[model samples]
Target: MPRLIYDYTKSELERVSLSPDRFRRKLKKAVSNLLPYEMELLQKWLVFYTDNRPELRQCISELQSDHKGVC
Candidate 1:
């Protein structure tokens, strides 16, 4: 199953020793500071999904590998 948004966000913050609420507040402020066009681009990318599910899975796996190396 896909992870819930709250669970994913909470785990990510915990991995970096960040307070989830504080991080969210900061993110909200940062997003609010974006220009309208920038925000529109962000929304587009945020909602983009692959038509090929297998390719999406592979992309996510590759990202997870990269994340493991960095973190």
Candidate 2:
């Protein structure tokens, strides 16, 4: 089964060592501070958090493009 939003976000928070509030701040910072490649990964992670397969697939496709000389 696919992961739920709660589980995904919880794991991400632990991985980054950030409190919920700080994670939110960092996510916002990423919007401006991250490079195109980094942003694509972030976007894919965010979409995965939603547990929406179609959207996640779309994000993955875009992320793949970033690896193919698009970024």
Pairs that collide, model 2: none
Instruction: After superposing candidate 2 on the true structure, give the runs of residues whose Cα lies further than 4 Å from its correct spot.
Output: 1-20, 50-71
Predicted candidate 1 versus true structure: per-residue lDDT over 1-71, tens digit per residue:
22344345434433532343453443344344545555454334323522343433344344436445221
The TM-scores, one per candidate, come to 0.30, 0.37
In Å, residue 20's CA in model 2 sits off its true spot by 4.5
lDDT by residue (tens digit), candidate 2, 1-71:
22343345446544653344455544444444555655566566665553544533444355446455321
Leading candidate by TM-score = 2
RMSD of each: 15.2, 10.6
- Judge candidate 1 at residue 9 and give its lDDT: 41
- Model 2: lDDT of residue 19: 44
